[model samples]
Target: MDRIAILKLNGFLLVTIQVEMHDQLVLRLQDDLTQMLERTRASGVLIDISGLDIVDSFIGRSLAQIAAIARVMNAATVLVGMKPAVAITMVELGMSLAGVRTAVNVDKGMVLLHEAAGLEAR
Candidate 1:
């Protein structure tokens, strides 16, 4: 029952998925993330998936669901550290990850969030 921890930083929620996850873990993450968003009142979410070697359809849809939920909560979602192969595979698998924003790395992700939230450049 290892769950992904959501860290709140400078008005944003940061989650780094370090291992391949099962369906239950993914569902729990989505629930926890939305709850965190509401409790913390964070303006954005930065998801770092650099350690993940693959992005299966289930995981991709979960990401999109998280992003969608965050959007309705008035929080932006930025997915960073997606490998080229994973991105290609995601597309090939028909997961467009629509409505989800992405960045090259966490630093750029933060910038994207700040810009979207209209915060002063950090």
Candidate 2:
């Protein structure tokens, strides 16, 4: 797995992960994302997953968990850049992402976040 990248901008946090789609990556992401949410006290989180081509059960569950945690932290989480093929595969596998918000791309996700947080996009 590659290093996870995190950036903070305008009270929103962006996380990018470049790694194999696997259980370990999901666990690490959970920990890292949880910490980021708590430490930043962010209004929203944008997760970019354009690099990932596959979405497994473990990864999907981890994402759901992250969204839940963000809510508890008083922040909204938006998943962005999901590939169409990966989306189809996830649906076929009966993996339901409960309590998770998704956008077609990062720009849309940022807009959603801004609306959710009642902030004007700059």
Candidate 3:
């Protein structure tokens, strides 16, 4: 997998992962995210999943875990660009992403992250 793109915008770190949606990639992404959160002291995070075709349990779990860790690190995490089919399947599978915020697009996700972090758009 290629190195994920991390962009900082309006107090949020936007991460665009360029890999197949799989367990291993998700775990690696999670580790990188955790380190990024800790090192950057970012106020929020937005994960753009627009390139992903499917989201498996492991990937979902990794996202949730990342959100949890981000909160502890004083950052909010939002998942963006979830495909409709994948969202439906996740809902049907009863997969709970309790603490993670989600949005239909990167723009919306950034807005959510900013709102959660009390950051005014610049």
Candidate 4:
């Protein structure tokens, strides 16, 4: 099975979604992230979706689910690097992406995570 490249940095998991995700791939990612979170005991998840031009409903739901599951595991999820058009489209599509925090970019997301976790940003 193909796996998404998830990087661990300063106790946070960084997931940069660079490709169009199908349902199976998204499911696999959710599973992999959950397991990784448990193993690493990470405090936060920062998902960078800048490469994705559009987030269809499936992907949006997957992101929401990932955030919710991460929260249940005591980890916060912050979505970042969304394109302006993508954000507009998501809203037009009526996907609120509830329960998920967001940042304008990866850098901002990192800062937000650090602040939320009470960790000093480097």
Q: Which candidate is the best by TM-score?
A: 1
Q: What is the Å distance of residue 52 in model 2 from its true position?
A: 0.6
Better of 1 and 4 by lDDT: 1
Each prediction's TM-score against the native?
Answer: 0.97, 0.92, 0.90, 0.95
lDDT of 2 at 38: 82
Which is the winner by TM-score between candidate 1 and candidate 4? 1
6-103, model 1: which lDDT tens digit per residue?
99998999999998888999999999998998899999999999989988899899999999999999999999999999999998998987778999
Per-residue accuracy of model 4 over 73-108 as CA lDDT, tens digit each = 988899999999999999999998777889998889
Best-fitting candidate, scored by lDDT: 1
lDDT of each: 0.93, 0.85, 0.80, 0.91
Instruction: Using TM-score, rank the candidates from best to worst.
Output: 1, 4, 2, 3
Clashing pairs in 1: none
**What range of 10 consecutive residues in model 2 has the weakest lDDT sum?**
16-25
Can you write out model 3's per-residue Cα lDDT over 13-88, one digit (the tens) per residue? 8888656766666777778878877778899989888787778777777888888998989898889888898798
Report backbone clashes per prediction.
0, 0, 0, 0
**Tell me, what's the RMSD of every candidate?**
0.7, 1.5, 1.6, 1.0
Q: What clash pairs does model 4 have?
A: none
Candidates 1 and 3: which is better by lDDT?
A: 1
List the lowest-lDDT window of 10 residues for candidate 3.
Answer: 2-11
